[model samples]
Target: MDSGDILASLGVNGAAAAAHALSLPAEAYGNDAQLEVLWAMKAYNHAEVYFNLISSVEPTFLKLTKSDDMIYSKFREDFPDMDIKTLDPELLKSADAKEKWRPFCNQFEGIVEDFNYGTLLRLDCQKDYTEENTIFATRIQFFAIEIARNREGYNDVVHSARAKAKQQQDQC
Candidate 1:
């Protein structure tokens, strides 16, 4: 199966798991930590699906370019166990994955710049409070992954050109 199919399957499984976890009795719902874990899993699953759908496409590309029947079929098959009734049709329609992803990329760029600011502040601070700086640190960590992924696209282009040049050199 393609990456999209794999991601869709994972998303479906994640939704099912989250629903099952949520169905537990109030007392059985456990603590905030458990809830956080469930939410995190859901977030990861959604992100994987979104990224798989959009990552390779050009900027400003629209998911609507794909057939609606196909998109709906994938969504239904992947999330069969979930309560999709609450899903926003408008949001889904507007979620042209490629175009929407630009904001995420921009956020990632901003976070990296913010990290540079943090580094400057850290140098001026008398005592280390790295552990206490969870918010900014977490932002940095997450954005770093985004930045790396973004860089990978550019690297692929450059690498392809280098390979082509090397091939020509070898021919000479």
Candidate 2:
């Protein structure tokens, strides 16, 4: 039977669970191409949901994980002058960026689950997720950048804009 048939037999909820489970690579999986694509799509949707959440609320008060304060502190210490609000995509994907980020990411090796898992991150806090605005990075890196962006008030505009839109909708 085809893979589609197998998935179809599982039903919609089962298929969704399967996709989420396959999104993270395991030792036994051994880098399957299909699994990688599934992971990418799941990561993209995760990012989209995160962006929507932050835009609708005050990002500064949101705690993504239990270690929010610790993550933000380390990020600030490691990247003192880095302007995450205006972060450039090329800079984030550059070899230099990886080299610099490795040490920061490594600090949370045991503390953060799936710290090295691939994830999608937005280049600018002011922009919505789009093909041109997103980049691939490790989960820890995404959290660090986003935590810093939130704490630094870069994401405040999203909340204000969303509130304005809601107010207009309510009036109409």
Candidate 3:
């Protein structure tokens, strides 16, 4: 009688298909921009897993990590008029940050088009993922900050957590 029963009656794998299908926003049902963001988020999520794993094992990766924008400096040597300062900061938020960010985003328009900007996602803060301390960030901003965080050692706390977890499991 309800949506679940209707789905079942229609012979859809109600539980399995419903789990993924109904979870999307009505706007995201077919919007290419939303779909691309979702797909990019999936790849970014996988990259985060590997980023955490590799940085945990070798802190040097954390020591050496750099945002995509950071490579701009090297490019400047060949193109003298190319100012690397035009790149966005590693962490971005607030209206002013967005205003200052237009040029950088323009350069990557093919890749970062949606700039829709209002959406929020629950995520692990580099130090702690507590709801109280958590901050909401836009999708593109997340890419910038995370790249900087991993490089700047903001994720070093994860190593300690992993160590503590291993010790507990070993004792068990």
Candidate 4:
């Protein structure tokens, strides 16, 4: 199926889930570091979904690389002083944006994790169909679902961030 089909399948709830996942604070949305983190998280999620879906159609495909390393590097560049050794759950929980999102962030993350790895892998290993078609369908579907879900949240974040950035720029 194409991206549209995937989105159509996800319906409104799926779209909401994606939006909630990508939503960021107005101040942080435009920060390169923040964008990198969000994109990295998004890419990782997409890769997982793609992998699972492909595996479902073809069980022999098992290749794992540090594809998400770029995103990590970006984060490091943006926040060089940040401690990388540990992830503080409290930090995520205490985040201003998270507070704004309330329980939605947790729910969104859960859904992304669930669909990304397992589903993609399962789809990849399917032995009953053509690999090329399946992969294409999976990619499109995943992309569409993600885009539809996150577009609104992404836009909101970006717009708010841009406005804040402009104010800061004027101050400078």
Worst 10 residues of 3 by lDDT: 82-91
Q: Write the per-residue lDDT of candidate 4 for residues 1-172, one digit (tens) a residue.
A: 5544655676899756656755644454556774454444455456555444333332122222222233233333433453322223343335672463334323334333332221121122212123331222222223322232222232233234446766899999
The Cα local distance difference test for each model comes to 0.37, 0.83, 0.46, 0.37
Candidate ordering by TM-score (highest first): 2, 3, 1, 4
lDDT of 3: 0.46
In model 1, the clashing pairs are none
Which candidate, 2 or 4, has the higher lDDT?
Answer: 2
Per-candidate clash tally: 0, 0, 0, 33
Model 3 segments more than 4 A misplaced: 1-92, 112-126
Candidate 2 stretches with Cα past 4 Å from truth are 1-27
As a TM-score, model 3 comes out at 0.45
**Residue 99 CA displacement from its true place in model 2, Å:** 1.5
Error of 2 at 171 (Å): 1.0
Compared with the true structure, what per-residue lDDT tens digits does model 3 show for residues 11-106?
656445544653566575766674454444443444456456643564325422233555233223323342222222233455775575555545
